[model samples]
Target: MIVAIIDYGSGNLRSAAKAFERAVAEADVDARIRVTADADEVAAADRIVLPGVGAFADCRRGLLGLPGMSDALASAVLEKGRPFLGICVGMQLMATVGREHGDHPGLGWIEGEVALLPAAGEGLKIPHMGWNDLRIAAPAHPVLAGLASGAHAYFVHSYAFVPADPRRVLATVDYGAPVSAVIGRDNLVGTQFHPEKSQATGLRLITNFLGWRP
Candidate 1:
C-alpha cells in the first residue's frame, strides 16, 4: 500500500513517516510511506494521512492555500473511496468549525465542532497529555479491531471533538469528560491522540489501519 502523509506545514511530518515505517516493518507489509506537500502525490496515494500539530485555524489556512490540496485530498478519499486517517489538529480540522482562535470553519467532512475541553476542577491541565485509555464504542472498525477497551494511547491536545452524530463516535477517553478519541464514518478515520508517540499499542493501531479493509 502507498501511504501519503499530508504535509501542510503543521510539522511532525518526519515523525509520522518514521512511525508508519516502523509499523509497516513490524507488520511485514509492502507499504511505501512518504511525507509530501505535493498535491498530485496525495491524489495518487492509496492511503492519505493528515497529520498536524498546531492551531486548527492556522492549519486550515495552510491547507486552503496548498495549491490543489483540498481538491486532490477530496478526490482521493471522498471521491475515489480510498482510506484517510487524520491525527491531532488534523482530526480537529475535519470538524465543521473550531472554537479555537475564533469560530473558524473546518473541512466540514465530519459533523462536529472542535471545542476546548471542559474544565473539571483546579489543577487540571488544559492540554491533556500522556497515555490515556480508549473507551471503544465500535469494535468492528478496522482502526479499533485489535484494540480492546482500555487500550492506551498518547494524547496531547486542549480541544476535543463533539461529533454532531453520536453514532460517528467510535471511541472516547476520559480526561475531564468523555472526549472523542476515535472517530470514523465509512473509509475515513481520525484520532485526537498521537499514535506515533504512543509506543506499541499505537504501532499496532497503525498496522491495523494499513491492513484495514474498508
Candidate 2:
C-alpha cells in the first residue's frame, strides 16, 4: 500500500515523513511513504496524511494554491473512503472556517469552526505548546486502541476546533480549558498536536493510523 504524506510547503515534512517511516517499520505495515505535492499521486494512494503549521489563513492558502489538491483529497477521502489523518493546522482545516487573523474557509469535512483558545486561567499560555495529556473521548475508536490513559501528545497552537456536533470529538486536552485535541468521523481523523514530536505516544498513534482500516 502507498501512504502519501502531502507536501504543501508548510509543515515539517521531513520530520513527519521520518515518523511515518519509523511507524511503518516498527509496525511491520506493508506500505510505502511518499512526501508529495502531486495531487494525482495523493488520489492514487491507499492512505493519506496532511500535515501543516503556521497561521490558519496562510496554511489554507498554501493548500488551496495547489491546482487539484483539494479535489484529490475530496475524491480520495470523502468519496472513496480512504483513511485520512490531518495534523496540527491540517487538522484545523477540517473545520468549516478558521478565525485566526481573519476568517477563512476550511475543508469543512468535520462541521466545525476553528477559534482562539480561551485564556482558561491565570498562567495558561495562548499557544498551547509542549506535552499535554490526551483524554480519549472515543475510546472505542480503532485508531485509539492501545493508547494508555493520560497519553501525552505534543501541542503548539493558539486555536482549537469547536465542532458543530460534539460527537465528532475523539479526544481533548486541558490547557486551562478542555480543547479539542482529536476529531474524526468515518474515514477521517485529525489531531491538534504534533504527533511526530510526541515521542513514544506519537509513534503509537502513527502506528495505529498506518494500520487503521477506517
Best by TM-score: 2
lDDT tens per residue, model 2, 144-178: 88886699899999899999999999999987778
Off by over 4 Å in 1: 120-123
Scored by lDDT, model 2 comes in at 0.91
Q: Scored by CA lDDT, what does every candidate get?
A: 0.89, 0.91
Give the alpha carbon lDDT tens digit for every residue of 1-214 in model 1.
7999988899588888999999998889998998988999999999999988888889999987899998998899899989889999888888999999789999999988999887435467988888899999999887887888889899989899899999989999987678899888989899899989888778988998898878
Against the hidden reference, what TM-scores do the models get?
Answer: 0.96, 0.97
Could you tell me which 10 consecutive residues in candidate 2 have the lowest summed lDDT? Answer: 119-128
Error (Å) of candidate 1 at residue 105 is: 0.8
Candidate 1: worst 10 consecutive residues by lDDT?
Answer: 118-127
Candidate 2: C-alpha RMSD to true structure equals 1.1
